[model samples]
Target: MKLRPLLITASRWKQIQQPLYPWVVTVDRIMRHERLGNMPGPLVHLFSDYGGAHKESLYETTAVLYMDVDNSMPWQVERLRVRQHFLPDGRRMSFKGLNDVKKQQALIPFLQASDSIPGVLLVAAVHKSIKNLCWSKDVRPDWPSDRAMRHKWSPRTFERALHVSHLAGLMVGGLSNPGQEVFWFSDEDELFANPTASNDVGNLFTMFTSVYANHPFKQIGLGTTAIDEGDRYEEDHVALADLAAGSAADMLTELAKYAGHIPTKVAIEFPGEFSRKTEIITSWLGYSGGNLKKVMVVLEPQGKTGFSVMRLNW
Candidate 1:
């Protein structure tokens, strides 16, 4: 994409030197390499979903998928075909909902088809141990004392911040176009429990990119929808991100058990027998080509106060 790189100011550069620095660098590299020379349409659509919030897992994941299509009809048509073949009863497709091995295998070809959809999938997996660190004050210094104190005690608050930060990071790194508008759709969660919270999230996103990325969208719009009541077109995109996030969490959780120690970087390999969900995601990632690209980054604790970022390769 003939996009301009974000101009990080001296002050922003200081913040970038924090724990999330490695992740930002990784994202920039992936975006520049994969999206170079690809012109985006007038509008860019970003669909997002998150997973691995439970305390049992070692990481929480946020997945964002962006496409530069002026017309979404092609994507909708393929979504309908996949739904008719796999779920004709109006049931929604989800990562956790795919149970039967044969059905998962059957769905692989459709997901792997080059004509299915055109977009780039970005997944951010953050270690749960990050909650113990006190870096939010540096990340968002404008927060009032009461809010900052709450974040210090509330894991959910910390998670919401991480989610927004990663979303903003991906947008600045991957989807930077001068006059191109952005429409972001996210699955309903505690992050957007009410209209006021939703607006706050939107404002935070805009402010984040403006201050840290030194790039802001011409017009940024945000929407939230429940999984059961959402429009099919929106749901399909969100479901793709949901699958990716959940699959990454599953694989990383298993990998954590096997690694036992944090290495500087570790290439991702399925260390054990794959579940139906992992198998489907693995097949999809392995076969992704032609206008569709996928990248996964994991941020794990490096020391008492630092983090290491590693790109996960299939």
Candidate 2:
């Protein structure tokens, strides 16, 4: 089959104040490694809950969003949370706030409309409006923009992530070798109110960390040293090392298998105290050999930007 044309929009979500430790570094690392020329065209859209960044970063974001957009198309985006406006066709853009509910609220319509575009991918901070959102009837995923999204965001397993990814793929006629992508963020059928078993969360993180440890794959990006705003594309990159000993997936799968059913909620939970769980989960996942762990921008660094307790896994 011919390679696909895909557009990806990924935002690093944060609910904390301190620096984004190992996770953002990981995301940056992965993004720097995001060189998928095999496909027709690739565009990346990235945003962050934390703002006040230099224009260089902001400009990069705009450039990515504008890539491949027909110069004459009527493409405009108004982001309230970031206090920015985008008219890629016109090359006009502006940003407003770091955390404004009104601004964030406005994006709902835009997100709902995204599925209509062919091959368009949407990865953002998990918003209730976005989560509970239902697309308009006229919108379908078969569009070129939506099709691009389906090509990239497909899942890696039988989890909810896979459900969402596959749904998008099916919507846009996007198919990789059936086994290539199995990830789905989740399906509405699996979208009921989450059931939080007290210890289940902790166990979930511990298990995934183990999988990372034992998995044969290494992070596609280079992990860097600890720093506020860690180096963007550091000089030296290391291939990921082996885990201490065992793999987490093997045990967890067995745990689930013994139950004779898939787990509806297998979360990597945190201490009973905090409302935001990303950093907490990231830390827990770090039990791997590496002192500083790597995750995505979704998780916080708990004050340390480059120094995380969790190790990066494959």
Candidate 3:
């Protein structure tokens, strides 16, 4: 099957600092483009395609849910890796395979888009590498686990599952990341890529900190939302419809009103067909916030999802 054949302009292709996501999302990325020929960084193999194993399929779906949980520490790290192309100390993104016309076309605008967000940058190393993430088990993801499918469930196990999935998902997330610029889709017609600069992230955090000064909502990463100009999934909200309704602006606007309350949860809700598990609950560390509970992820064959609730009286 042929896709819409998305491509970037020639000028833009000549100066891409990071490989944008369209290459990763497309069915196959292995092309003869010359851009991929000169990559220079600590080379870490990317797990682009999924395996035919039960666990492999559930990786992304389960991982996103795991991060959504309230307590998880959201680390803001520089999103770059070394590929087998450029010089070892290379700060700029060097590629060789993307030298072809079509591939270059795809890379140009992605770089253009990269210019808007300042949160990303080159790096000497990262705390964790791509090999770290990939938490999948035989248990179904779209539905509840059998042991605690009903009301009587264990919060500890649920969190364990989430942590496992999160670690796995982070591996892939870090690899494909064009940097801190989260490509967001908004319902009203906005395509956002979180600024990659530390200042940009700090600015965002400061803005939220001031607005949410009184609200318990501790601002996490430069939050984002969806715009209607959607075609494919990048990250964050994978499903198109989920990109609608809510946007970074909307959430900020709403949260501004609740500055006086304890920020139990920062609502980053989006529209249509959002992650089936709108909210993920887990206690992987074997502890919860008393009100904390268990999160069950049941993965269906083609990536369908279901949820379960567990109450732990700690």
Candidate 4:
């Protein structure tokens, strides 16, 4: 994919800022020929995954994949077939598992064929140094002391929940139809490991949707499941987001070294060492000509207090 400067519309950008992350950017792309409004009872399924949250990384990335339930079966079948082709013994396909050129090559055909399934991959990458600058002061500052005491969370968990909720709000605001049901499935993560934290996040997401997104839906469901225990097909969708998040995080980390000052509209060039993983990631980012639309919104810090949002294109 290519990189360019992006200008987000003011209204949409305002809604996306509800998380109050200080540095947030939203990028959206629709590749399907049919208009979203024309679709019948459009049920949205969102699968999310995150990467680069470790202390050593400069950027943390979150990826969310949105798909309509109407195309779920066919997409699931195609994914299963692809998995079987590569792993006859019935193993799972994961970003980490694609360790060699051969396995990475196996992904191209499936990704190419996935064009029939209308989907959108949305990614948000934030600079870790500023991620928690004014956490308590900015986010829900007026929360009752009692409620705050009851629903205590570490800053890290709060940040993770905030990302997921904000992404869900954006998805609903941009994609959902009236009376349509929306479901969210995420790969097991520490944010959801505790039942209380998970429930709190779910409640926060519902509130965010109703207040910020302003989209009416029949119902909203959230599920956090282990990859092995969850439906294989759904897990595959999460895996796709996982790969994207990892790739975006790695790309940003590498870009930061040479990008003394982030430019406006420049092609992405990693002059450093490129491993097999990087090769696969670059290829995936370059993919086009399908119903699977991809958008990457990079929120780079400008000064100590502000940031810039740019959309990367293919």
Top candidate on TM-score is: 4
Comparing 1 and 2 on TM-score, the stronger one: 1
Question: Where is model 2 more than 4 Å wrong at Cα?
Answer: 1-67, 71-106, 115-314
Candidate 1 per-residue C-alpha lDDT over 213-308 given as tens digits, one digit per residue, 9 for 90 to 100? 445567877786553363466777777888888887877777777776334543444347667677668567655455567767678788798786
Stretch of 10 with least lDDT, candidate 3: 120-129
Q: Residue-wise lDDT of candidate 4 within 174-277, one digit each (tens)?
A: 66667888888888877677777778778767765775565468889888645345346666777788888887777777767667544546665556664567
Candidate 2 lDDT at 71 equals 20
lDDT of all predictions: 0.62, 0.22, 0.22, 0.66
lDDT of 3 by residue, 225-251 (tens): 332233222222221112111111122
Q: Against the true structure, whose lDDT is highest?
A: 4
Alpha-carbon runs more than 4 Å astray in model 1: 1-23, 35-39, 71-73, 100-106, 113-116, 132-135, 140-155, 212-218, 226-231, 265-271
| Model 1 lDDT, residue 173, Cα | 44
Could you tell me which 10 consecutive residues in candidate 4 have the lowest summed lDDT?
30-39
Which regions of candidate 3 are displaced past 4 Å?
A: 1-100, 120-215, 218-314
TM-score of each: 0.78, 0.21, 0.18, 0.82
Query: At residue 26, what lDDT does model 2 achieve?
Result: 39
